[model samples]
Target: MPRTKPGVGKGVLHPGAGVGKFEVRRFHPDPDLAPFVEHLWTVRWDLGDAPPFVQRTLPDPAVHIVFERDRSEIVGVVRGRFERVLVGAGRVFSAKLHPGGLAWLGAEDASRLTNRRVAVDALFAGVDVAAREAAILGAASEEAMAVELQAFLRSVAPRASAEAARA
Candidate 1:
């Protein structure tokens, strides 16, 4: 099936925004990780001298790992709508995991994480958080950031339980 274009239904959260102000890119996971991952998305923006932009979205069942310049977090499914304000010039790389994919990361119940944000180290224990953060934030472009993120996921290689597999 052909993938829908990015930003197609994204207007509710980013209304009146011109397409040229920022860039949104999506990528499929590596073949081995496809079942556990829906896709990766990166949003890069350079709104020089423009006012802050507020973006909102309806709740989604999938979990997400969001990487930013100073912090990274494992976000659980949100039961309510989500909102964020974009300020300055920066980018964010995120992994949208399949609804059941949280089990692969040792989460017993994905719903428990709903509306909660956990430190990356809490979910990815033993991984070098600082080094990984540096690599991701230091990437030159969105594509490079995606590559770094995919490599990190591959290195961790979390496994889904039988129930998750069925999901």
Candidate 2:
């Protein structure tokens, strides 16, 4: 599986690409968690008085746990391009799960989630959605947010099965 992103204009189709105040930051996964998680990344943007920016990307076959200011979700594989509109100033922190780690700590089959988007509660039980989301998104810095995300994952993530590793 491709753990690294397709560079530049390929998978990334954002205007000005890596230029401007919009920034994408990726933090390495915890050493022990590396087998299941590819990375924890955050996108921060500040447009001040400028027009909203449109960013698009060719998503890979994987699951993503996205945490925004107001909502958190688990998104399955996207067979198409992903697009988002950026306005004002905001940041989003997310964890990209490997294909071999799809089951997470749940018994649900990863195949059942193809092209679907579900609430984080659907996958993680006994989690305080508001509290966790607040702890991560409300963090003062991206590093702090990444740390919170890793802690959250460590609390619930599962070990990859041998068979699942080859999927």
Candidate 3:
């Protein structure tokens, strides 16, 4: 199930997950985007002078659009576990897509992207991806980042098809 509340990271597997040292939150999609977007999310961590922390989790099989500074990506469904190393200080805003959302959003098929990542431009073409990424990442707060991402998601909602929507 998608997390509907803020400050929750159900998939996070760590001591005192999604709080304090590791901050995360989930925001529900707007009504118009409900079909394609499961939820929008943000993750922030500041390890400061400490050693890098490796985050581990068993992720659900779903597509995701992760927006970072200059490194935004369309992440495909992962069949296994997930891990990412966190260090220093950083934050990212992302959208968790529904099962058929990838196809609806422009990918030929979700299966083609399995265990792979493509530049966000592959799907959301024509937009200034770098500029958009910068705006989202540069937002002053997590809620602001989600708003930026939600606007982007809403911008693409019109292109989705009914068949793909049902998928």
Index of the highest-lDDT prediction: 3
Compute the lDDT of residue 36 as modeled in candidate 1: 81
Residues 1-167, model 3: lDDT tens digits: 23256546567777464356677778887665777888898888998898888888777788889998777898888888889888888878899988887766656688898999899887767878988988888877776777788777756655744543564
Backbone clash pairs for candidate 2 read none
lDDT of 3 at 69: 73
**TM-scores, all models, native as reference:** 0.82, 0.82, 0.85
- Model 1 lDDT-worst window of ten: 1-10
Candidates 2 and 3 compared by TM-score, better number: 3
Instruction: Write the number of the candidate with greater lDDT, choosing between 1 and 3.
Output: 3
Stretches of candidate 1 exceeding 4 Å from the true structure:
1-18, 158-167
lDDT of 2 by residue, 1-167 (tens): 11333333246775575488687777777666677787887788899998888888897888888998766888888889988888899888898888756665554787778888888877888788889999999887777888788888777755434433653
Q: At residue 83, what lDDT does model 1 achieve?
A: 80
lDDT tens digits by residue: candidate 1, 103-143: 77565577788889998788778978878878977887666
The candidate with the higher lDDT, 1 or 2, is: 2
